[model samples]
Target: MYQFDKRIVMTLDAGGTNFVFSAIRSNEEIVEPITLPSNGNNLEKCLETMVTGFTAIKLKLPEAPVAISFAFPGPADYVNGIIGDLKNLPAFQGGVALGAFLRKHFGIPVFINNDGDLFAYGEALAGALPEVNRMLQEAGKNKVYKNLVGITLGTGFGGGVVRDGELFLGDNGAAAEVWVLRDKRQPVYGVEEGISIRAIKREYAQLSGDLRMLSPKDIFEIAEGKQAGNMVAARETFNHAGEVLGEAIASINAVVDGIVVIGGGIIAAYKYLIPAVMRELNGTLEMYEGTSVDRMEMKAFFLDDVADRDAFLVSTSRRIMVPGTTETIEYDSVKKMGVIMTRLGTSKAIAFGAYAFALNELDKC
Candidate 1:
C-alpha cells in the first residue's frame, strides 16, 4: 500500500467556464492554482490548455508529481477515464480518452471521475461527513453517519452518493444520477427542471407572470430586500424547490438513508431553502408515523365521549399500528438524516478528492 504522507499529485478541476490546475498534497494543502479558459468549444485547444497548465505546475514542484487526477463532468465512461459528448463543450462530442492520453504524455498513473462523484467523495472523507461525525461524538451520540448524498445546484443539478467512506458508482458508474429522475409533479420534466438555477427562474417567472429573463441572483436580491411584489414569488420559488428536493431526499433515503451535503452557487440562498426542506421532511415523518394498537385503543377510550370520535379514528388510521402496546413506540424518523452545506468549497473539494482518489488507487497497486 502506498503511504500518502507528504505525497503530492497534480490535480485539475474542469468546468464549463475554466480549467483550474494545481498541485495538492496528501494532507489536502493546495499550491498556487493556475486558471485558464476551458476553450470548451474546441477539443484541441482544451487538451492543449490542460497540458500546458499541468506542465507549468510540474516545473514549479520540487519533485515530480506522483500522479495526475482530475474531476470532469460526464456522460462518459468513468471506469475507463473517458469523457463522452459533453453538451457544454461540443468539440468533445467524440469522446476523449482523457486518462490514457494524460498518462502517456505525463508518464504517470492518471485517475478521473465524474465531478459530482468526486465532490461527494471529498465531503465524505474530509468535509461534511467528518464534521458531522465529530459533532455527533462531541454531543455524546453513539451514532456516526458514514453514508452521504451530495447535490450541486448550479446551471444544472448534479448528485452523487458515498457509502461507508467510498464513492458509490453503482453497476454502470451512474448510481446517484438524481437529475434524470422524472419530476414528481411533471412527469414530462426531469427532477433537474425543479432543482436547477433555470428551475428557480422558471418558477419565479410562472409565479410573478413576468417573463423578463432574470438570473437566480437577481431574484434572490429581490427576495432578500423584501421587494413588495417580487418577494413572494421569489420566496415561493425557493420554497417549492425545497419541497421538491425534500421529496427527492425521501426517495433517496428509502434506498441509502444517508446525510445530505449541498453545494454550488445556488446555496448562497440556503437560508430560504433549508427550512422548507425540513418542514416537508418532518411532515412526511408524521405522515408515516408508526403507532401501537393498544395506544390507539387507549386514545379511542379517552375520545369515546367526544363528538368527533370518528374523525379522530380516521386520522389515527394513517399511522402504522403495532399490536398490544399502549406505550408510545419510538420509531426511526427520516428527520434524523442531517443536511448541511459543504464545508469545502467546490474547487478545493474536487482537488482534494482527486488527490485522495489517486492515492487510494496507488495503494491498491
Candidate 2:
C-alpha cells in the first residue's frame, strides 16, 4: 500500500545488529538505506549509530524529512518516545528518551511505536481493512468498517488495534498483548505456547513420535505430503495452534470489535490453521445457568474462502419508519466479521505504517 501524500519521513528498521535507516515519501522508500551496527550494549554508541545513519539518509534524500518514525522493541512509554528496559537492547535499561533525542538532532517531529501497533495501523489504513471494504462494496453492501485487529504468528504471538484510523495504544501503551492469554489446551501455559514456532515443533515431535527437532517449515512440507513424516501429526500441530489463536481472538473481540488480520512467518501454514480458528471462534460459550451463547456476537468468516466471503457480504439491513414522524432510518440486523491474511508483507507494512503515521500526526499539528 502506498501513500499519495508527497511529504517525506525518515524511518528505521531497528535491529539488534544493523540499524537500517532510510527516507520515505508517498509511503515508499526514496533513498538507499544506510545500515550501521546498533551497538545495543552501549547507549552512547547506539545513539551515535542512529544519528550517523539518519544523517546519511537525509543527505541522500531529495528534500528534508518532515519527521522521523520507526519501530523498536518496547516496554516503552511510546507516547513520549521513552524506551524502558528491553531484553534485546541492554542499553535501553533506563527510560531513554529516544524520540526526544531524534527530534532535537533532526529538528523535526519524532514518533516511535512498536511493530504490532504499527502493523495494525498499516492494515487499517491501506491493507486488509481497505481490501475488505472494497469487497463488501463490490458485493453491494452499504456497511463500511473502520476498526481492525491485526495479529502476527511467529516467534511469539503479538497483536495491535486500530479504531477509526487511530492506533489504539492503551493508557499504559500495552494493549493487545495476546500472547499472554491463557492457552486453550494448557491453561497453565501462555497461549503463545500453543500458537508459536516452538509450539509447532514441540507438538509435531510428540505427535509423530519423533524427537529430531524438525523445523516448522519441514513439518509444513510433511503436512503437505511432500516430506517424509507423519502428515496427520503435522496437520494436527497447526490445528491445535489455530484453536488457541482463535480463542485469543475471541477474547480480544469481547473488548474491541474489529475485522481481524493475521500475518508473520507462521502464516505460510495458514491452509491448516484458519479453519480451526473459525471453528473455535464460532464455538459457543456456556453460562452457569446452563444456557449457551455464541462465543462472538458476529460470525467469523475467513475472507479467502469464496463461500465465506459471499456469506459475510450478505447484509440484512432494513429501512424503518418512525411512528411519530416521517423520518426513516436504516438498521442492520445481521452481524459478521471477516478475517484474512496480510496483503502487504510484514516488513513493508511496518515501513509504510511508520511513514503514514508520521504524516498523519504532522497533519494534526
Over 130-206, each residue of candidate 2 has an lDDT whose tens digit, in order, gives 99999988988777999999898877788889999888888887887677799998999999899999999999998
Stretches of candidate 1 exceeding 4 Å from the true structure: 1-4, 226-229, 285-335
Q: Tell me which residue pairs clash in candidate 1.
A: none
Which candidate ranks first by TM-score, i.e. highest?
2
Query: Which ten residues in a row are the worst by lDDT in model 1?
Result: 295-304
Off by over 4 Å in 2: 317-331
Question: Model 2 clash pairs?
Answer: none
The TM-score of candidate 1 is 0.83
Q: What is the C-alpha lDDT profile of model 1 across 1-365, one tens digit per residue?
A: 11256788998878788888888776455568889999999889999998999999998787878999887887888878888998877778877898888899999999888777878888888888887777667655556787988888887778889899777888887788888876655768888888788899999999999788788888888789744348888888888888777667666656777777888888887777776665555553323356422211111111112332222222222244477866455443222556678888876676667777888888879
Q: In model 1, state the lDDT of residue 75.
A: 85
Model 2 alpha-carbon miss at residue 6, Å? 1.2
Model 2 CA lDDT for position 32: 85
